[model samples]
Target: MTVVGFRSSIGTWGCAIGLIGLTLCWPAITPVSPAVALADEPAAAETPPDQPENDGSTETDSQETPSTGRTLEDAPTLERQVLTELESAPHWPARALAAIRLERFDCAPTRDRLIEFVQHDPDWRVRANAIRSLAERSIEQGEGWFEEEAEPRVIRTALRYGYEVDAGRVHRGVRFLLRSNRLDERLLGAEIAAASGKDDLVADATDTVRSVILRMDRAQAGLLSPRLSAMTGVRGLFSRQDWMRWFRENGRRVELAETRRDPPNPHPPPAGERSFLAELNVDAFARFESYVQQWPELRIDLVFALDCTGSMTPVFSRTQSIISDTMLFLQDITESPRFGLVAFRDVDQEFVTRPFRLTQDAEEIMLQTWLQEAVHGGRQSESVLAALHDSYAMSWREHVERLVILIGDGPPHRGEGGACIRLAERARTRGGIRTQVVEPINAPVRDFKEIAEAGGGRLWTLDDYVLILAELLGLERSDDIDQAFMAFIRHYTELLR
Candidate 1:
């Protein structure tokens, strides 16, 4: 088995090709004067370097002036350059730059181009940037675009725009969005309501959010709960009852003091490194009849298709810890586990699918190191179908149980729904490969249930990952086998620290 060591720098650079900054920001729209564009000089002062955020602040006396002194004396020339870049940029990165620059103009042509970008930009980042651009122009114009836009990024950008520019507009738009049956839209509305501190919006949408959470299965809960907590600033509210109690007790008092330019982190920083014994906090008392009965462990060929997107960075770290630290345990199972890993993110982010072939390497040192160096993903929605298809293509040993554990936070790209289920169905019936899903915290479990069911596998939550895997592998908590495993984890954590 040739396990090559390789890495790609897809999302780490900011000079021109990759993401401008690790922090998410609205790229400012600066109009370059014809004099500046034509002359041997730098661009205008309005053109700030592509920083992730812009805090609506002007340069004070202490701030330095632009090296180039070309002023916006002629609107027509600046407008022409913006239009030219929007239409003629050779690459998507260049196109994204133009889209960001397009945010400054208020003319009809500018508005039309933004709309076009929102509708047709193949790159979601560019489209999202366009949405922000359109929103910054005017709330009325943004609301108009919202009527025609359905992408989650566009809707999210519009909501933030309303929160940034006009609260009443946010309330109206959220009200309309919450009325929809679309889960993503409703969730966006709920988050905005919680963030905006609009009592009326909260009163109207809390019930809906609660209902959705209540209807979700365990895997779905694991993924959606953390997001709700972050958006509402409610901690540890994982159950439906918890949400109801919070609303009844403090919903009215929930007044957002100001628009949060940066939303709080979903995965809060840990308090401190726990004692090695803490790693053995397995749910021994909890029963695992469903997982054990439906999908017992066997000699298996496994593929872990993971979401390596930006939002998943926290979970990704945890995942790396679990996989790398438990290599000995994974190898010691009655049916030795041969693992193939696929690290995936959305299109236009970094590399889409970085695959590692099936191996039972005792250390998995290379995989561990590669995980450390993986670039952060750019967008939220990932290429689920692509990852699953790649997983299904891996070579499997004869007479072994074949499994693919697909994990991620958000749903698949638009128009690619049910594609995974279809593939899983075929793989199960014809190829004997069962596809499971380990929905990471805050991941939406929309079609993952269907995918698991189609492959005759149980859908799992990241919260129950350890317990379920232990049970499947016939490893008991606190047993010699388990202790040895925890010891390895302890050593791994200490070394990393």
Candidate 2:
């Protein structure tokens, strides 16, 4: 197994390319930048090199973007460069590659480097890599780092890695992060709790998890004035302890416990209450004045595959309204998000808009007006199967979820919609893609199963469009959304019951 040893001045140097060798198979990571050679040069990210986050600041003062003139080779070339560079140096970037490689390899040096990075690395993402690297090694050693319990990202990374590489650790980590006030940390905790297959781990938080949460709570409160509401985000991160205990007492399956809906409040429903799902993701977005306020996860990409066909005229009209609302919603969110649009016709799908921030009122207005101009002229000869099968070519990205909401009501003109569904399935399973299909009632049920199964997505009938759209946006905390996610999990696990 290939593993990282340490960082040196000459970029990332590698000893063995044991497991990192597998990355060579991916065929895309070619043309890595030449080694900077010095101990100090601007790192590839926007922030300055190796600065710890403190005082509620996530970034450093420097905005040193990696030199962009360097053109990337195709996937295979990318893989060759990554493999060659990682094997040659133990610099930060090399260490990063080694960490990922160690996920497939393992050794004492790699483990130690990971531990050191987790404890001392200034970059959160680098630390994130260290946690992931350790978890991968834990696959064999079975004894991962118990010392990183205090860090939220470490805890979250542990939970994810644990579920895949070690169930017990994942179980423990989930509870630890759930009791964290940091929403990102807590949400990650929820994902871990939901993912753990072990009945005990899923059913009960370990003493370690409890201790971690308590310590984190204390840490957040300055280790002096322990407060109550401050604990709720962390506390509710996992379901109430009583709920878990009850699930254990009832001998419920871990899967069932996970899929079960949150309990209805004892308090009466407020009069004239409206379902968040009914509002539509495009519409509810209007509520957030800022990207951070609009969603718990900060990064968002809105991609619309609009149908340009005679039958889809009305559906396209609704698309127009959603587009307007989305533009307004963008204004509230952070400047980081990107919005893009595509028009699908009978023969092919094309990009009519580029990713731009809603922060620019002029840009948003132009975007909406552009959406109007393109909606009509695009021909409808393209097949839904063809449009999506080729989507990865246009919109794929790393570290962020890609949401492709297709508005249409028929089979693809090229390959069967079944092909597109299979492709979608692969993307979401890898956590790099998501697809939501909207179609008219009489379109076709045969393809619905394919899209839903492969894409790890939901297929909505236009008649029930409101319900499905809400679920897509994750707006309602209800049964439909619950089942929709159950479908989501089914994509991840084969033993669907």
TM-score of 2: 0.33
- Per-residue lDDT tens digits for candidate 1, residues 288-354, read 2112222224576767787777776556545554444344334432245677888777678667787
In the range 1-497, model 2's lDDT, one tens digit per residue, is 10011111232312242111111111011011111111112234454568653432112112222222111222245443443444344334334433443333223433444555655665333465655444433322222233323333334344444423334445544554455444333434544454454555544433323433343321122111111112122221211233344335545422222321222222222222322321223222222112112243445555656555556654544444444434333323223445555555554334422233222232343233233322333342346665564454455445554676666665554455556766777767765667777675346644755676577667776545445434444555555444333332222121100
Number of the predicted model whose TM-score against the real structure is largest: 1
**What is model 1's C-alpha RMSD?**
22.7
RMSD to the true structure for each prediction, in A, is 22.7, 22.4
Model 1 segments more than 4 A misplaced? 1-298, 365-380, 474-497
